[model samples]
Target: MSLRLFNPRVISRAALPSTSRTFIPSIRRLQDSSSDAPANPKLESIVDQIASLNLVEAADLAQLLKTKLNIQDVAMPAVAAAPAASADAAAEAEEDKPKEKTIFSVKLESIDQTAKAKVIKEVKALNPTMNLVEAKKFVESAPQVLKEGLTKEDAEKLQKALEAAGAKIVLE
Candidate 1:
């Protein structure tokens, strides 16, 4: 290998090669040179100074170097963590349940005088404002209401109508 002498103090005027393979051609030339080049005094002094420092001094120096040499400290924007539930969600849940019927299932025998107590019992079970004739009418209608079966909803409506109609001749 032929040796090419280069002045160490002078910076090269040519642009450094862009590729990784050619990044340090000057270093490669020194390696190929026959004459020994003195180790860089500045680099040697810096390395020796770092090695000599105590732990606290080394940490402070490192922090200073980082502050001076750092290129970027950009922060990325954060995304919303969770989507909120809408007001319509509660209404949707309520709509899913089966609506209770307003009818009642009652037996026919409760209308008879002997079974009057049972009629009163069933009437008060659904509504406390029930009186004798209203109870009787409700009991008498039991056959028709129970013909195909009645929901609690229908029974409640009939009971209200009977109560509103007031006292009447249940047997006659």
Candidate 2:
């Protein structure tokens, strides 16, 4: 079992090469020693000072700089950061987007007999120009549309109001 642990293929102690290899400096070190040297000490100090500032102080400094430089806020154009295939897939997904309902019609399907009076009052309240008798007649009519071509918000509001008054309403 101990002999199995020591493999003959594995060389435990390898002899070093007779000749030493020459050291070659990296391209970055070579470039650093050339014309492209370190940044200006004053600029680096300013950057270090800015980095030390807290969030609010940094924001105030940024605002001051913007005002001093008369810099106007300009929105940057949106760039698609996805790969070509992903961008094509995204465009196809956008093209396959479902149509959203904007305008809706509020229909009064029916009103409970017991809540007829309450429903009538709500209908009259909904339309202030309608008299009580007209509103009552409107409420009596079954499966009649109350309001048409209304926005989603208005339709939802009317639906809630009528439902609360014990009326069956549908928004189409």
TM-scores of all candidate predictions against the true structure: 0.24, 0.46
lDDT of candidate 2? Answer: 0.84
C-alpha lDDT of residue 116 in model 2:
93
The segments of candidate 1 whose C-alpha lies over 4 angstroms from its true place after superposition are 1-27, 30-37, 71-172
lDDT digits (tens) for residues 70-170 of candidate 1: 84556865434432343356567779977765534533422445645654565655556777777656666654342225665564555544444331222
Give the Å error, residue 70, model 1.
Answer: 2.1
Which pairs in model 2 have colliding backbones?
Answer: none
Candidate 2, residue 84: the lDDT equals 88
- Please give the lDDT score for candidate 1: 0.56
Residue range 27-104, candidate 2, lDDT tens digits: 446777687578889999999999999999999998999999999878975566757877788889988998798999
For each candidate, the alpha-carbon lDDT, in order, equals 0.56, 0.84
Report model 2's TM-score to 2 decimal places.
Answer: 0.46
Model 2 CA lDDT for position 34: 80
